[model samples]
Target: MNNRSQISHGDKSRNTRLGRLRDLVPVTSAIVGIDLADAKQMVVVCDHDSRVLARKTFRVRAWDLGAALDWAGQKAATAGFAGVTVACEPTGHRWRILGQLAAERDMAFVCVQPLISAWARRGEDLTTDKTDEKDAVIIARLTAQLRCYVPEVVDETWGRLRHLGARRERLVVELTAQVQQMRDLLECVWPAALTAANYPFRSTTWAATMTVILDRDGGDFTRTKRLGLDRLENLVRKEVIRWGAEKPGLRITRNLFAALDDRAGVIAHRRGALERVEFLLADWLETRRRRLEVEQRMVAVLDGLELTELVTSIPGLSAIGAATILAETGDPHRFSSARALVKHAGLAPRERSSGTFVGRTKVTGQGRPGLRLAAWRGIWGTLRVNPVHAARYTHLTTRGHNRLKPTQAQAAVAAALLRQLHAVIVTGRSWDPDVATFGSRRRPVEVAA
Candidate 1:
C-alpha cells in the first residue's frame, strides 16, 4: 500500500489536531528528539506507541555537534526507520546549530517554543524535578503530540536587513537621548543661548559655532581695541539679534557665557563629541537608506506575488504596512474568514462570563503587535482624508461609544480594510472602494415604540 493510503485513523486524528503535522513528520520506526542546552543536550528516541526506545546525554562542542548528527543518523539506521523526525527545544542560540545540522541531514525537525515548554512544565506533577534529561522527554512528548507550529526559516537577506533595521532604530534612539542631554546641559548655563542664538547645539554648524564661543576668554570679549574681541562681539551680537534676545536676556546670556568660558575645555570637548555623533548619524542614515531601498524592492516583488494591491489601496496602509501584513501573515487562506483576520489582528473584543457576573468587554490584544500598530496607523490616516470615516468617528463618540474612540474607530476601519484585502487576494480582483464601504455611514435604525 502507498504511504499516503497506509495512514491509520489515529494518524489522521493527530494530523487533524496539529494541522499538517503528520505530513511534516516522518512516519519512521523511531523518532529522535534532542533538547539543546548551553553545555550539553539530552537525546531520546521513541517508537510509534510513544515508548522510549533509547536515550543519551552528550556535551555540546564543535566536535559534539558533528558527533550528535552522526549518532542520530546511526540510531535511525539501526532502528530501521524509513525516515526520522528530530525534535528539539530551541534554547538560546545553541539550538541554531542543531537546526542547521538537521537540515543538512535532510531530517524533519520540530522546534518547541520555550513558552509551550514552560507552560507544560507548570502543569506537570513532578514540577520540582527540572533536569536536562527530564526536559528532553517533555520535548519529545511535545513534538510527538505536535503541540506547536513549525517556525518558518527566514531568508538570509530578510534576516540581515531586519538586523540592520533594528540596529538603526537603536542608534537613532541613542542619538535622540544624546541630543536631549546636550540641550539640557546648554540650558543650565546658557538658557538664553538657546533663546538668543536660536541655534540647536545638536546641529553640526551650531556645534562648530558653539566650539568657537566656548574657546573664547571673557577678557577677549571685554577688550576695547582688540580684533579678537571685536570679532567675538560681532558673532554674539548676530546670534543675539537672530534669537530675539531682549536687554535683560542679553545680561543673563552674557553671565552664562562668562561662566561657561571659565571651563572652556569642557564645552569644547562636548562640541567635538557632538560633531562625531553627527558624523556617525549621517553614515548610519545613508546605510539605512540603501538598505531601505533593497527592502522596498523585495516588498514590491512579494506584494505582487501575494496580490497586495487592494491592501495598499486602503487609505492609511502604505507599501510598508501592506508588505508587513503579507510577510507576517503569509497567505490569508490560513484564516477561514475576515473575522479570523480581525481576531488575529487583535481588533476583536474579549468577553467574560460567570453565571450572572458578566465582565466588561475589552480588547484581547492577543495578536501580532506589528500588525495591530500598522492597522492603527492606517485608520488614523484614513480618518483625516476620508470624510466618511471622520463622520463615523464622530457618531461613535456621540453615541456613548467613547471607549471606541477615534483610535478604536481606526482599528475597525483597518479590520474592514483587511476584509477587502482578503477578497481581492482570494478572488483575484482589484479592490472596489464603493463595494468595500470603507468610510460609508451606517443608517440609523428607527425604534418601534
Candidate 2:
C-alpha cells in the first residue's frame, strides 16, 4: 500500500472512534434559580431535563458564587453538555451581584417575575409555606419556558435621577400632609384663615403669608389694631419683589393681597394653635424648597438623556413631566402593546365575568401606582394646553357614553391619552393634532430607530 493511503485510512479510523464517542455522550445543561434574600441566598441548580443537580444555601459573597459556578460547570461537563444559565428573582436591588457574576462567567442571566413564581407556587400547592428548595425548582421549570424577563439595568446616571424623582414625590406628599395639619391647627382658633388665604395649607403663598404675619410685632393679627391690613399688603408686595425676581407677573402679589384681606380677624389666639401653625408652615416651606431642588435635578438628568427631546415634543409635557413618565414606564417598546402598558400601570380593566354572564369591569389597580399617577398627571397637563386633547375631552364628556359619569368619561380619555403617549414615544414623532383627531387614510407611523 502507498504511504498516502495508509495515512488516509488511519485518519478515517480515528474519526469513526470520535463519532462513536460523540453519539454516546448525553447532552446536559443547567438552569439556576436563586431565591435571593438579604443575608444568605437559596441556590437551586437543575438540568435542562428538570433534574435537580444541587440545592444549597450560600452566603452572598464572591467565594460562594465561584463555588456555585464551578459546581454547575462540573455537573454539565460530567453529563457531556454545554454551560449553564443563571436566573434569579429580583428582590429589590439584591440581584445586581448575581447579574455581575453571570456576566463575568459568560452565562445567560435572567430575572423571573416574583408574581409569576408566587402565583405558580400558590396555585400548584394550597399552602403558602415559603421553601427555598421548592421555589428553586419552580423557577427552573418556569424559566425553561422563558417565563422570565430582562429587568431594566439602570446605570449610575439614571439611578441618581430615579432617586431624585422618588425623593421629590416623598417630599410632595409630606408637604401636603404638613399643609393639612397646618389647616387643622389654624382651624382650632381661626377657621376663616384658609378662606381668606384662598389657598391650601401648603401653598407657597400660604407659608409666605404666615411668615409675614409672624414677623409683624403683633403676632396674632386677629386683634387687628396691631398690624393693619394695608401694612400686611405691603409685606406681600415685598415678598413678590424678594423671591419673584424680576418677573413681569403681579398675579402672586395680587393674590397675596387678596389673601391678606381674608386673613382679617382670622387669627387664632390659642398658644397651641399658634405654635403648631408656625411649625407646620416652616416645614411645609422647607419641603417645598427641597421638592424644587429635586425637580431641578430631575430636569437636568432628563435633559442629558438621548430620548428626552422626543418626549418633550409632546405638547404640555415639560421636562419634569417627561422625566416622571419615562422613569416609571422604562422603555415604551418593551411593552407588547399600549394595552399591555395599561396593564403594567394597573390601569387595565378588570372583568368580573363567568360563563355568559358578565359583570361591570374596573381598573385592576394592582400594577405600579406611580405609573398611574404620572399618567393621570400627564393627561391633566395635556388637557390644559393641547386643543386636540381639549376637544377630545369635550367629546368624551358629552357623547362618548350615554351612561358614563363625568369622572368615568375623563378616565376613558386618560386611557386614550396613555395609548397616544405610547405611540408618540415609540414612533419618535411629535404629536400632530391633525393626524390624531381627524380620520386618517395614511399608513401607520413607523417606530423610531
Candidate 3:
C-alpha cells in the first residue's frame, strides 16, 4: 500500500473508525474506480473501507479494460469480495467505451461529476500533489460511498440526428458569413445592385441574374468595357432568355432581370477582386440546399420515433426542432421529472439571494447549450405564431411582481415550452394546441383592493 493510502501516526482515531467501517461493510462488495482519459485510464480497486487493493494504469482499449476488471475481481475475491461496481468521472464520451464494456460484462457502472471528484480528491487533505493513481483511488472510495449516477446512452437514430443538427447549424452559419461576404463584394463593385434588391444573395431568383454576370467570356467585369456594353448586355439578355425558356424555376427568374439590367452599369470597371464571388455564392446556396436535405432526413427519422408527434403538436415546434430536442436530450426516461428535463437544458431559474439583497431570477444555463438554443428557437417562433405561448408571454410581461424584461420574457417562454415538452414526453401524450392548457393557465395577481 502507498503511504498516502495508509492511516498516519497522527490519525489513530480515524484508523479506528476505518476498522469499524471495514467490519460493517459486507465482504462481498468491491468498488472499481477509473480515472478516464482519451488515451489511457488509471484504475483502482478498493474493498469497503477505502483501502486500495490494486491500482494500475492501462491504455484505453476494450481488452485492457476487460482484463483489468477480471484481475481486479480476482484480487477482491482473494480478499473475500464478490460483488463489484465500476465507476468513473464523466469525462465527455471517453467513458462510453468503458461503460459499454462494463454493461456487457454484467458489472454495475456509474458516473460521478468531475466537480464532485475534484472536491473529493482535495477534501481536508489539501493534497496539492496529484496523480492519476491518487485520483483513481479517490474515485473508487467516493463510488463505494454511492456518490455517482448512471449515464444514459442515446439511441442510434437520435445520435445521427444530433450530428446532423449540429452540422446543419454550422452550415447555416457558414452560409450567413458567405452571404455577408458576397453582399460586401457586390456593394463595392455594384452599389445599385443590392440597392435594387435588398437580399440579392438569397440565391433563388437572383442566382440566374448573378450567373449572367459571371458567365462573361472576358476574365473580369473590367473586360465588359473591352467587350462593349452592348455585347455584355446581350450576354445577360441571352442568359435571361435561356432561364425563361429552359429552367424549371425560372418563373422567379423574371424578377431578377430588372434588378440586373438597372444595376449592371453601376460598376463601370472591375476590381478583379471578386472574380469567384458568383461561384462561391452558389456554393453557399448549395450548402443551404444540403441543410434542407438533412432536415428532411431528420423529419423522416423523427417520424418513426415515439413522442415525436407529441413534440411537434406544440405550436412553433417543427418536426426538425422536435427531433433536435429528443436527440440532444437523449432518452427522456432517464430524467426523473419534467423539472429535471428543464434543468437538464439549463432553463431552471437560479436563485441569487444574499443577506438584505435579492437578485432577479435568471436561467441557470448550466446544461446542454444546444438543447437550450433549440428551445429558444421554439420560443421565438411561438412568440411570433402560437397564440397559447403568446398569451403566456403576455402573462409573464404583465405579472405585477418584477415584470420580465424582453430577454427575460423570452427565457421564461422558452422554459415554459421546455417544461411543456417534457410533460408531453414523460406522459406520452401529443401536444394539443387547439386545446391549449399547459402554458395558457395563469391567474391574475391579487393586488390591494
Candidate 4:
C-alpha cells in the first residue's frame, strides 16, 4: 500500500548480470539517487535490493544539499543499511554540487550515463513518460544493480586546462564561421581577390590589401582602378609598412591590378556590401586575436604539467593538442590499461552483428568528444611526420584482405595514438619509433623521403 513498496520487480535472474559489481553494492548498503535540476533536486533512497525507502525534493542550495544527504543517510540507517552510495545521471553541471557535498561526508558518489538511464526508464515503465520523481528512482535502481561508475576527481591544474580547452574550441568554431562569411562576401564583391595569391587571412599582406580596398572610395573595385597601378602599389606598401611588415613587391602589385580589372561591374547594394565586409573583417580579426590568446594560455598551463613532455615526445602531437587531451583524461595512470584509455576516449570499435547478419563496425563514440577530437587532430600531424604512424595507417588502408576505409583507418590510428599516449605517460618512457608499431618485427617498408 506504500509508494516505495509498489516499485519492486520479482525477477531473480537479474542478479546474474551483476557479476563482480555485487561487491560494490552490498546488502548492507543504501543507494541514494538524485535527479539534479537548476532550482531543485529530486532525491530517492533505495535499499540494496532496489526497494525504495524514501523520496524527497530539496531546493538548490548548500544547506539544502546537506539536508538532502542527511535525510538520505537517516533513511538509509532506518532501513538497516550501513553505507550509502549517491548516484545521479550527471545532467549538466548541477550534479557537481551534490557530488561535492556527498564527497565531504565520505559517501560514494557515482554517475549513471544519461543514455543508460533513458534505456532503463523505458525498460522499467513500458512507457516514455518521464518526471523527476521517476528518474530519481530509476537512478537509485541502477545504482543498486551497480550500473554506475565513480567519476575522476581532478586537481586545480587539470581543471584549468579543461575549462581553457573548452573555451578555445568555442573560439575556433566562431572564427571558422566568421572566415566563411568573409569568403562569401569576397566572392560577391571582389571575385578576383581570392585568386591573387591565395594569401591567408592571418598574413600581413592580405590584411593590408583588404584595408586599402575598404578605405579607397568605400571598397569600390572601380574606384581602385583610378588610383592606377603605381599609386595603388604605393598605398599598399605604406599600409604594409605601417603594420611593420615588408612591402609588397612590384609583381604582387601588378597581380592585384590585374585581379581588380576583372572584377564584377557595379552591382546593387555595393555600399551596403562593403560595409558588411568591413564589419566582418574587424570582427574576424578580433576573434582570431582572442583565440590566439587562449592558445597561448593553454600552452602556458601545459608547460607546468609533467605529462606534457612525455606526451609531446611523440612526433606529431603538439603541446596544445596534448594539453587538450590530457585535460579531458585527468590522470592517465588512473586508467587500468591502454585499452581502458582508448575506450574512455570513445575510440573503441563496436561491432554490430546478430545471428546470420553482420554489419560494418564503427567506434562507439560514447566517450568524451573533446578528448576524441584532440586525439584525431593530433593524428593528422602524426601521420605527416611520424613514420611509424604513417606506416600503420598505410597498412590499415592497404592490407590485403581487410582493407579499412580512409576514415576508418584514421579512427584506428587515433585509437592507437590514445593507447600509445597512455603507455608513455603511465610507463614514464619516451616514445621509441622502432617499437611503436604493432608489427614492428616485419621487414621495413621504404617511406618516401
Q: How large is the C-alpha RMSD of every model relative to the true structure? A: 9.4, 11.9, 9.6, 7.7
| Pairs with steric clashes in candidate 3 | none
Candidate 2 structure lDDT: 0.68
How well does candidate 3 score on lDDT at residue 393? Answer: 84
Once fitted onto the true fold, the runs of candidate 2 whose alpha carbons sit more than 4 angstroms away are 1-28, 61-67, 200-205, 215-269, 306-309, 350-359, 400-403, 438-449
Tens digits of lDDT, candidate 4, 1-449: 34564543322223443543565556677999888887788988987667789988887653368888988999999988897888888777767777788888888788888999999988986678799999998898888878887677778887888888889889888988887887787778766766665664656676667667777767667788887878887888888775447876456556667876664734675567777777777777677678878888888887777666888899989887887777778778777678778888899988899999999888999888888888888898999998888999999999999999999899999998888888888889878776587424356689999
Model 2: per-residue Cα lDDT over 33-60, one tens digit each: 7887776777877775667877778776
- For residues 77-118, write the lDDT of model 1, one tens digit per residue: 778777677777766666667767778888776788777888
How many residue pairs collide in each prediction? 0, 1, 0, 0
Better of 1 and 2 by lDDT: 2
All candidates: TM-score? 0.62, 0.78, 0.77, 0.86
lDDT measured at residue 440 in model 4 versus the true structure, 0 to 100 = 43
Best by TM-score: 4
> Native-vs-model 4 lDDT?
0.79
Local error of candidate 3 at residue 261 (angstroms): 9.4
Better by lDDT, candidate 4 or 1: 4
Candidate 4 stretches greater than 4 Å from native: 1-24, 222-254, 353-358, 439-449
lDDT of 4 at 39: 75
2 versus 3: better TM-score goes to: 2
Summing lDDT over every window of 10 consecutive residues in candidate 3, give the lowest-scoring window: 243-252
Query: Ten consecutive residues with minimal summed lDDT in candidate 4?
Result: 8-17
